[model samples]
Target chain A: MLTGVVPDARYWSYTLYGADDYLIPNQDQRYGYNAATMDYVPRDTLNPEASDQWIDQYQIKISADQQEGNWLPAGNNKALSITLRLYNASPTVYENLATIALPEIIKVN
Target chain B: MKKTLIYFLLFCASALVGRTVAIHYLPDYIYSRFSKMALSRPGAAVNQFSVLMAPDENAKLVVKPNPDFAYATLFYDLTDGPIHILGAMPDSIYWSVALYQENTVNFYVKNDMQYDSDTLNIIISDDAMDQEADIEQIVSPEKTGFVLIRVLVAERDEAHQKAISDYLNALQIP
Candidate 1:
């Protein structure tokens, strides 16, 4: 897992998609939740420190029993796709920061 | 009967092995050769404003502001493997980081919880620090490859914009 930082500017937010180009099943409601089912979860509430009796309070499951927000399935055998949307909210003139290309493959194994 | 069963099992195993070998070897051979050629050869960088692609290191990056033109982007090329982004921006600007797969224009992981707007302002203000954002999930199938970092600069003044551009150009994955 690699990490990067985006500085504070005006207004910015990102949206993620799965291999099928659909919104990954987000247990955390922080990312946009499903408007139809409203079955979204938040990360903070999952932590025990943040919420007392966290485990007792809620039982969560992704498409299957994998990581919390892991959009991909278990096993290193399959391929998945991902996408990113960057929104810049500055009131003035337009500015071009960067354009990123999606990876061709993501292997777990 | 026992001999016949053994023969059948052996046949099945051979067939399975053959299929697996074909499935795995063919794609590997094609991809490896194609990627080698693509990386070894020098080609024009894809994005116009600011883009970086390094096949040996297995990374690609693009930095473009939004169409509205409020902020700038620091996208990565996680085509082959993951890459880390480390840097800072001016004080009065707000920014966010996101992960996307190769060839797609969507985010794989949007860090709204960890580094929300309020959190970003504070973190950038206090001191110059570095953070890690894995792109494994976002760029699946690529397996352990590159990541995109989008940095939005608010000030957008002549000096700030120029600084942002220069900073992006100077980015090194190492």
Candidate 2:
């Protein structure tokens, strides 16, 4: 399962594309998802307005078992890379890119 | 056989140099071609938003378009005078305005987080300008280029898309 805590930025987007930058053709025509576009799958009890967890929590469940929030469709073996683009990002984000903390993409057996 | 091999080597060397020159000049060539095309139009002017034509599946002007963002461009020429771009505050959404130089380099840009306000203003000035801006101006070494505005659509509905398109189309240099 692909999961990560997205960075804090004015605008962030997670785009899953083929190895090349070309959009992967899909049945639903859903190529990727962005911060404004993606659904918030609740995993924590944190408030969006109160805390920054709204922009942090992200879990892409690969299993066929459906879950809450919005589905970040990366399954069906079509994705090659999930690009995280942070626009108007914090200065610290760029300063610490080499050591930035990113959640792991765990394998579900 | 030896003469033919030398001629082939000479040809390869010239071809490599030719390819390098073409590659290095490609961006400038494209920029000038497009810039002239844009300015040739009667309404082409600086600091104004011109909504690009709808995306054609068979053709593309730029490249790698995101359907969620509406694209608009402003062709600018500082020959007459320095132009000011003002008033494009995106309503709490993702937005970015970028300026490209004649050489196709992104010389200046401001995003929502950087400058999110009702009075979004930027003056593009060359070195010849004696006046100064109270606010920081977008300094451009090149006097000619284009500005692109990308606004993220909040909803995927047709009505919302149409609204976004209308909003984008309404944007112009005042």
Estimate TM-scores for all models: 0.28, 0.67
- Cα-based lDDT at residue B109, candidate 1: 44
lDDT tens digits, residues B4-74, model 2? Answer: 99999999999999998787888899887887776666776555667753232222344444545677788
Per-candidate DockQ versus the true complex?
A: 0.02, 0.17
Among these predicted structures, which one has the highest DockQ?
2
**In CAPRI terms, where does candidate 2 land?**
incorrect
**Candidate 1, overall lDDT?**
0.35
lDDT of 1 by residue, B16-105 (tens): 999987776765665455334434545523121133311111122222213212232332333434443334433333334443333232
